[model samples]
Target chain A: MDKLGVAEGLINRRKLLGLASGAAAAGIGLALPELVMAAPFEGLVERARQAGERQVVVAGGTGAYGDLVKKHFYLPFTEATGIEVVPTGGGYGEKLAKLKAMTSVGKVEWDVITLSIDSLTPDVTSLLRDLGDCAGLPDVASQGVDGSCLREGVMFDIGGGVLAFDKRSFPEGQAQPAGWADFWNVKAFPGPRALPNIGNPWWALIAALEADGVSRDALFPLDIDRAFRKLDEIKPHVTVWWKSGDQSQQIFRTGEVVMAMLFSGRAFRLRGEGIPLGISWNGAPLDAAFWAVTKAAQHPNAALALLDFIYTRPKAHAEFAAESFGSTAQRGALDFLTADAKASSVLQPANWSNIVRVDREWLAANREKVLQRWSMWIAS
Target chain B: MRAKPLAGSPFGGRPTSAQEYGPGLSLLLVTPLVLLLVGGFLYPVGKLFWGSVFVPEATFANYARILQEPLFLLVLCRTFEIAFVVTALALLLGYPVAMAMARVSGRTAMLIAACVLIPLWTSVLVRSYAWIVLLQRNGVVNNALIETGLTGTPLRLLYTQGAVIAAMTQVLLPFMILPIYSVVRNIPDDFVRAARNLGAGSLQAFFRVTLPLSLPGVTAGVLITFILSLGFYITPALVGGPGTLMMSTLIGQQTTELLDWPFAGALAAVLLAATLLLVIVFRRALALNKGFKLG
Candidate 1:
């Protein structure tokens, strides 16, 4: 019995090696320098068929974001490639924990994962495989996607944290809050405000600094002490420090706070629901969510193919952005998007100059210290 | 006559069916459970302690940082404060219900038991959300307050420290009630009756006799509720605002948000040690109190 078991294990191991080699051959065939420039998707489906791995698992954010990915990205990818895409929904933090556990156990179950700029720290990046040449997708470069993609991951969608206010509080014709300064001027806006408690506090800190009259250009290497001091002025007025997207939406829906620094996507959804919401693009911090493969992924080739497929497909990207109320990372994607969709996006041409870009690298490097200090400040 | 054979007939002083199996056999009977406890509980906790010292290279730096950091210390103290408040509130509210449960018989007791158990059966997340719905600015409570002319403006009730205490007390009230209920229900009715007959008033009888007899249950309830509340993350996070930062929230931020496992483990170790120390002190207090004896 023991000998039979050993023999079966050997056979299985040999089968795995054979399949891996086949996948590698297909990868090389598709990745040839000559063919790479003309049509990235050419022969990709056939190559996937020869690759032998039939499925790729994805870990992504839940709720509307998860649904959009499943409908517009994963389902389409599966239809084109014949490789089943299993998408698991979770918060970025939960996904990170699961990835760490799986990698530490010498078995990684996920091939692709969605990561926030804050979670793309050095420790997390170390566990991810460099996409090599796949990192430089031409579509991504032309789109002016957040630069963090050039370093560690592939940017898929761009969103921002905007100062969203209930229209009931700031009625249609009345003077409305224009920026962080007005958000802080409670006497002017005159209602409780909400900020995020989860993730890095860079958005809040930068907004605080900007409210304190710091220039947009001088926001990097944030003055943490001064920012916290500014925050202290508004602390007593903040009714909710929401930790989840759903919670943020609920707070707005329930009128828990008259105004909140909320994700633009959520604000759009709330407006669609007829919630009488207003979003301010001034001093809004643009945040991009990225897709990266794990180091120990069993299907790296398939994962890369999926990443490339999503990045290059403008129509799919547009649809994803529209449905998710986010902006696509492909330049051509904007052409495909409706004028209304374009107008609503954080990356709209008119709104672009007013928004501030969050420095991902700086935040990643100082995440620990910033988190400790933020916790202390919040408690205080 | 014949000394009543010591109540066991011809087998007086002999080993009964229960004692037929020796202590060794009894230990063997429970070996699987012991092994499970060691393997599942002790092993992971021991690993957590080891990880605290060894991760990011072997050192006591994590522990030292936690000790030196005012934030960590403050969070720990705040955690205790919230837990104590919850425990006290639960006791205050739960004692009367438990006393009523003990006093009542049949259908009424079951109804009260069902009332306590139903909430306990619900998920903590659902319960916290319920509190949010009830306590938000324009929620039911505020709407009622406004309609009744109690106050023109809605009071801020949801995200304050008060919300954390109230929600936690609601979630943990069952833990406080069940232990006290079980103990109180077992107390002989004759003791209270005898006190009443001995010319003591009803209030005096309860304070001198019923309360003392139920001290063991009160201790158990307080200890369980306090310890459980110390590790409460979901309820507090959901219902409370940033000001209500607890130790569990810090540890969660470290483990999940920051991915600083070593610091998280260190935080967990401190919380675990503090909980165990408190439990020991509580047990010692109970031991010193000769009036109450727990089974």
Candidate 2:
């Protein structure tokens, strides 16, 4: 949490660990002397072993993306710490329900879980433990981009709802949309376009507000009325209000929309499959998934160890992020990625600089109100 | 386990039928259904009612909120509007098919029946997605329009309210056709022939004889289509644009996205009440035509 030096941190950890001078070698700092400079907890592996913790249950997603998480993070953590990784995959709703059920009965099955702006709130906070300041997460604290570490969770990966256009419309050296304002200019960039109206409406709202000449810094505490007004202009042109990521790609592949807002990961996959797609990071609204520990976790130390292990290997992080067409918190991970791999990665300066973080905190509080308003606005 | 012999019993406890097939057997035959209804339908509905009124300390707030918000009422109105439109379209489009099926040769009737049943057999989700493929900007409909010079530019058809109505009608057409087909198929051929013989033109004979006799099936078909369309979720969500938001969409949003179970319960209850009210009105209207009461 302290952006200053390590002199006080070492003393603080020393007292926190309460390890005698003779046992200094086995303290938190020395446990991973080579990898972690300042591990969050002392003797995490030793404590987990003592606690008889072997498997860390996670509500990890399924399919190709889930496999990537397992290969890149879980397997290595198991190898390094001797804890088996069990990923019981389900959708956000299912997982949240399970979490609530587990906690209500005082027996949580999952040790760690994923969180997004959608599942982050709606009165579901008591289920997760507040990782105070995330000070123990040295990697996230030091190397992560701004707002990477928070009281509730640490961001494991980041994706964006980006402006992905067909390159044929704006070929090389041709004038291209630089931001949301450009995205809104149908006269200049004429084509049927797509925007998501999936359960998540905030992404479209952010894009609309940005197009309405609101500064990126002043976007939060959203001007709902202004956003809807801007959306009115683009509503006619959005031929497809795609409900899923697959549909988003399908619309583009079939030329349903020459220019549209699409999930960055889906856009990357389309480009990889030989589509002449161009992704502009202009005012891209970031959709990040955070790694959170449950309050009812049986093995809290084991959960922390798994989270800590994520930041240990930058190369694995890069590979996982690239394969999924997303990005990790660590800027260093981007170094290991290929040029083609970094095309949709937030590590690219164009994307990273222009990226707009979704105000998750605000969204969490006003989810129902905003959703009701959105339902009314879109339908009306 | 004997079925009670109550004269006004809706559950078919009349002594006349139960006595014919040993009372116990008649009651036994229906036990599984009774249990299923009690467990699957009634229990869940009871729970939903309880949650709507009881969650957060026995308050009517959930139901009140639904009434308070203009959004809920707007969606409810829109849902009814879509249902009415779908029912009207299905009737207009389906009556002819039903008539053909009823009057055609047996082999042709079988083929027409197959056409109606095939789409009904197909998953609603798949059918909805198929509509998207056909109506998409670069999809078959647009491509055909462009090729034939029907329009200069591809029309935005897929995500519009019109698309929703079209898809919903297509989906619900089978429901409308089968009922009318069955009744029309049973209408005596002599009735129309007799009317025509009695100084009636072909059109007059058909309208007076065929149409009046087929009214029962038409009423039944309208009831089925209207009820189903009121709760339509997938077709509207897939093909309908923002302006076409329906009641089920709002209910789904509350349950899944917001996890507002109480509010979702209220929404469901409102839909159920509205559907029941409409069905009752339809039944009362149908009742005026003596001996034409539907099950």
Candidate 3:
């Protein structure tokens, strides 16, 4: 009986040790994948390959822009480097917030993120690693990259907010609105208008000041009080304050608003769809979208490789620009763009001179205060 | 007449029953769920509350700003106002459905239940989009209205305060229905029959006995609907116009557009506090009504 008891005790102890070791194994298993995923990808291309980590995630806008990036940039990059590229779509603000949260938590998921000029502020730049020394970084200045993309990010495509109106409302032989001044002329325009309420209100504010007779050169350091007064004049007539790109498109599609401030690419798409859309590029703010590598990216090398691939291969850049109705910053890419595409592009010489470049730095600095005032104005 | 032995009592004098494992064993069984709630819900909420004071320096500045700012205050009041309207509409619409469900059985009950629940299964975005289609200027409703000669021009129905309430009520109606259905179903038919036999009309029996008994469920439904409506963002955002700014919308702007986490947290904390205070007041009022009945 005593011998039986000793055997049972030994069996119990062995069971306890087995349970403990199993738990330890589970803990290690849980932690190991995150460690491998979080490791830097720079100068570790061979190591990454050995580990079979060949996928890089890229986050950008949805719909047409996302499709263009996938078809032209991601596919070509993957074909060249044998690394798979995954594209994730979200709003510009959402992506920025996600990146900030992910970096704070030290578990970066996206390798490359497309950012707006306004999002390239100091606070955001601090979270991004300077790509100056990234392998195969392009000469953005020589390539005629927009000023917004000259630092920190690779400027991929350029589009601007243009005054687009329903052709049905302002058809052939009708006096179409030409610029911000014409847009603010309610008596002449004589229809409900829409303006973007997304992100910063800089576009609307600048346009308002311009309508109020503030010259382009003296637009910066915007007079807030004066802008509000001008906005109030048109507020009663402004029917829709569109909050998304899709919503802006919808407002026009449904004929809810006769005129709207819309992204040029969307206007181009609408025109292509035979939607009878009229686009006025005069006084439009030239906006550039840039691809930047996250500081905590797990696949930084692959991201850098993709960025280089986009710039060096002018055909892919031009293809994306043509299909998406956006302008490529790479000068070499322009050679591949068809005459029709070039005519539609804001970067074309005739349209380029009429568009205004938003002072991103000034806008970034005053973003908070301006947004506060904007919200107050909207509420009032 | 010495309280002549209660019917169905096995024991003569005092009843003897099996002892329960008590609170200790019950708590032990619930430990995993408690831990999950603590780790998941409570921890994040605690972190959010902490973030409010700590960000941009550990100060009450964020809270102070929210309290002082007229915009924040206006948004808060608007949030509550919307929630109140939504809750009242849900209760009104849902009570009839719940009554019908309680009255029916078998296939009919299942059909009613499915009607209530199928919407819950669908995505909120899809439902909101559906509302847009039905309410837009040139949408189905407006076309019908124009064809029927209701008005010469289509009414602006898509982005009005009424649209928000309608959509919210539709989305939250199920929440209000299920609770009342369960309670109304459980009420014994004998009570209403007895009331009728005692020379009471059917409606009088319903008002005196059925409605009073169903107050618990009504209270639960109202509380649930009101709280859920307060945090509603998408429905209001899609269906309502810029004029229909709610607390959650402001919080979203602060978090995403402005990257003002501290201020967002502060706004959330204020909202949470208000909800809790309202809940307490509601419960107190309920308890007082019950006390009056007992007295």
Instruction: List the candidate 2 regions with Cα displacement exceeding 4 Å.
Output: A1-59, A81-89, A92-111, A117-137, A141-143, A293-305, B1-25, B286-295
Ranking the candidates on lDDT from highest down gives 2, 1, 3
- The true-structure Cα RMSD of candidate 1 reads 9.4
What would the TM-scores of all predictions be?
0.78, 0.84, 0.75
Residues B192-238, candidate 3: write the lDDT tens digits. 89999999999988888888778888999999999999999899999
Residue range A87-145, candidate 1, lDDT tens digits: 88687777888999999999999998888766667799888888664534444455454
- Quote the lDDT for B30 in model 2: 91
RMSD after Cα superposition, model 3 = 15.5
How do the residues B5-27 of candidate 2 rate in per-residue lDDT, one tens digit apiece?
66422234545664679878998
Task: Please give, for residues A1-380, the per-residue lDDT of candidate 2 as tens digits.
Answer: 32233222433443444343235456534344432344543456556655788889999778988998888888766655557999887887778778888888888889999867456663666678888887776667766767777677788777788899998878879988777888899999898888887767888889999999999999999888888889899987877778788888888788888888888888888987889888888898887788889998988889987776676667887878767877777777878888777666787666787888777788877767777777777777
State the weakest 10-residue window (summed lDDT) of model 1 chain B. B1-10
Score candidate 2 by lDDT: 0.81
Off by over 4 Å in 1: A1-155, A290-317, A331-340, B1-21, B54-58, B286-295
Of candidates 3 and 1, the better by DockQ? 1
